[model samples]
Target: MKIKAINGVKDILSDEIVYWQKIEKTARDIFRRFGINEIRLPILEKTELFARSIGEATDIVEKEMYTFVDKGITMRPEITASLLRAYVEHGLQVRQPIQRLFSIGPVFRHERPQKGRQRQFHQVDVEVIGAQEPQVDAELMAMGQMLLNELNLDVSLEINSLGCPECRPDFRKKLIAYLHERHDSLCDDCKRRIEKNPLRVLDCKQQGCRAMVQEAPSIVDNLCSACEEHFAAVRKQLDRLEVSYTLNRFMVRGLDYYNRTTFEFLTTDLGAQAAVAAGGRYDGLVEQLGGPKNTPGIGFAMGMERLCLLMQQQEGQQEEQGGADIFIAALGEQAIAFAAPFVHQLRKLGLQAAMDYSNRSLKAQMKQAGRLKAGFTLIIGEQELEQGRGILRNMDTQEQNEFSLQEGAAMLAEVIAPDKA
Candidate 1:
């Protein structure tokens, strides 16, 4: 039998890797500007970490997680729990009152894969630990919005309030009552979870389940004074920044930890995976996950696969030319030997340079340079080497110029260096 990548998982080949790098680079640059440092957590963590933090009743813990049998370890289906483990384990809150950390990595899930969803998917998680103010929530949301905007993605922001432990009891009571009224009509999964996780029905994708919950009471109207005020203040901050958004009452995110504020960045480009990014504020999670007494946190996560899917939908098979700024083509053995050091010096001077070592003919080497889409080709032939000169051929326009090999790095730097304003 021929070996192959498992179903629902696909490899990101070299040709498609440029887009991934561009996405990662854009995120890193924006994250730096926000004072959010990167945090790398393990791919696998104790099953108890997720079970206790994300809620054992949640679908992730009950169905999707890839757990081991011998020991109680599981591949992380999400990052928040692992990050919280690191935070509490390292006592990060003691070092800094406010911790802004982000991570981009693969997360495992055992689920039916479709267009964007996968068995092994990547998420860019941004978390702000040790903050309770609504502005922090708004700032995280704004930063996420800014990232998608910078990527030229046309996505809409939807925000919701799930209330806090103080007020959530009344809300859940009302929600359960409404759901119980339509219990018979609810989907099987919805029926089983109605009394336990009734809010989940609102976010359910099943058509029957969605129709049943449409007329159900909105959580917004049920928010208590403190939760209501926080939601109002968050909206006020967003309005102050002129960040347009819709108040989505149905967005009770799929997690037990999320409370007060939850959000999703939705895109119509991808079918089932509409949410390109989603996150919320979890106030009790730190305490729930055995952290400090009361460590508040807010964060958002972007699915790389979904984002790439949307990007590809917007921009088709246009290849980004991944090439050096200069390609050195040497004619003979002696010419090639001289070209190697020349290329190295150009690299040392911060120029992206490449050369043919096999001594391919001048015509063939020039063809290789053209394939690389190199900006300029420094051609060193037997004659040029004896004269200490190389013909520089422009890849774009079939123009050629001569330069001294002794002045290679300096000479190339002068040409490729960005112009001063």
Candidate 2:
């Protein structure tokens, strides 16, 4: 019998790390340019935090969250609730009236794993707290667009407004009534969603449920006067920024906190996981979680795994293995002792250097240098030690130059340095 990883989780091997690093690097650069600071949060929090923020009736809270019932703690299934909790507890609001923050890390969920979705997945979450203006929503969506564009991903932006509490009750009532008429045909999930969370029916992926809601009341049309104006302003800002988007009347977020200005970046490349990134405005969430009242917020999250998958799917996206600046091949014990210290010297001078510690044959070491794609190889042997010089061969051109052992590391560092070259 062999020990194996958990069924729903995945081990990200080194060869696949390049794609992940690219995604994270591009996201961090984008976030920096947008003035968003990075934040780190714990992987676990009180179960009530999610129950209060994600809605107790939602599938995430009811089925997916990995909760320790006795401890009342859960491995966070999402970043927003824990982030908000930190915001309130640390008095981040008092420090800065408005916060522009982002976090990148893994989150947990106890759901069936699929290609781009695992039990433990990573996300780059961005949030702006205490900013209620429609421009905030537009800019946030624009930032998401910029990030995906930089990543060279083929994703489209879709926007929707869930409407604020002022007018949502009436719309919820109407939506519930519309769902009731098709009660017999609704999927089991949507059927139950009617009374507890009618808005979620519009977000269902079931073919029958999707068809049923095509003619259902559009939440965009029923927005209250304030929400209508706010949504219009958001669209106007998006137009000013020249950000292309399509209106998705049926787009409703799964979380309870979302209201008005919802959006997602979707790509057809990923089959069932069409959304590569998604989020929306949650005006009352901070207050609901014990923060200051009326603190408006909006943010979005990009799935790292999905982004990496898309990167891998793209033709010519493979990352070339980086080569060492220099490789030293030492023939025997004396040469090994001399080459070892010289390798460290090159590294301290900001150069990538590699040398075999296994004391392998010169031919084997040369092969290792080729595999590493080393730019140059310095061959040191007992004869060379006696002669006080070594042969430096350019791996690419096979041109050999006499390297003086008297000057040693300093002269070698200058000779190999790109700027010096």
Candidate 3:
């Protein structure tokens, strides 16, 4: 039997890897600018960690989690659980207060795949721990906005507060009562949620459930004095920073631990999966994971594959070209021998250089160079090799220039450098 990758998983080929690399590099650079160091958490974590942090009744833990018991250990489906574990087990114990960290890696969920949804997909996550100030939330939001802007994506921010523990229970009680009154009209999933996780009733995507919750009480209206004040402060900070957002009353995320500020960046182009990124303050999450009590934190995670899809759409709009700076073609046996070292030197100088390793004829090498879309083609013939010189032909203009190997390499380097040429 031929084995194949399960559905909802797709391999990223070389042609598409550059898009991810660009996104990763940009995100890393921005995080570094914000003084966030990288933290690589394990792909797997204890099931309880997620059950506690992400919430046991949510779809992630209840329906989507790829949970299994191994050697008396329970493994979970998502990376956020492992991330929280790393924070408590290592970050708090080893690192200083107010740790700012980011992680980008694959997360798993047993879900049906569509255009942007996948069973296994990558997420660029940022977590700011130990900061209770609302400005931390603003900073996280700004960072996310900056990343999307850097990717040239036009997106809208939908922000809301899930209220704090001080108020959430009262709200949950009222919400559950209200949902129970409409229990007959509620979707089956939401009917179950009414008993187990009533807050998620507001997050139900089903049409009937959404309509029921639409008339249901809003958490914003039921927030305690402190949660109300905190929510106002977070909004004030965001406004002060000029981060535009729309207040979404029904924006309670799918997770259980999220509190106070919750947000999602929506784009209309992604079809039914409009949210490319979403997260918020999970102040109780650290404590739930057995960390410090009341360790306030805010963070966000972006679906990388979805971002790449949006990026491809943007690239299509821009109609950009992707190609290397130089292609080196050899004409003879001696030329091949000489060109190999020359190509190496060019690459060592941080230039993208390729040679026809198949030992094809000069005409065939030139054709390959054109197909590779190399900006310039360097030709090394017997005479040119003997003279320690090469012919550099501008692929676009078809204009040729004779230069020594060193000069040709320098010219290629200058052409590749943004500031130099």
- The most accurate candidate by lDDT is 2
Alpha-carbon lDDT of model 3? 0.83
Tally clashes: model 3: 0
Candidate 2 per-residue lDDT, tens place, 8-124, comes to 888999788878888888988988998999989999899999999999999999889999999999999999998999999998999999999999999999888898899999999
Q: List the residue pairs that clash in candidate 3.
A: none
TM-score against truth, every candidate: 0.95, 0.97, 0.92
Which ten contiguous residues of candidate 1 have the minimum total lDDT?
412-421
What are the runs in model 3 whose C-alpha is more than 4 Å off? Answer: 1-3, 72-76, 91-94, 315-322, 386-388, 405-421
Ranking by lDDT: 2, 1, 3
- By TM-score, the better pick of 2 and 3 is 2
> What are the per-residue Cα lDDT tens digits for candidate 3 across 1-421?
9999889989998778878888998999999899998988776666667777777678887678776756323444655667778888875735588888888888888898899998889998888888998878887998899989988998999998888867888888888889778889988888888878888778777888877677788988988888888888888988988999999998888877788999999999888899999999888888888888878888889999999889888645342347778898898788888788878877788777899877788899899998888988988888887788788899999999886776656666775454534
Model 1 C-alpha RMSD vs. true structure (Å) is 2.1
- By TM-score, highest first, what's the ranking? 2, 1, 3
Candidate 2 differs from the real structure by a C-alpha RMSD in angstroms, to one decimal, of: 1.4
Q: How many residue pairs clash in each candidate?
A: 0, 0, 0
TM value for model 1 = 0.95
Number of clashing residue pairs, candidate 2: 0
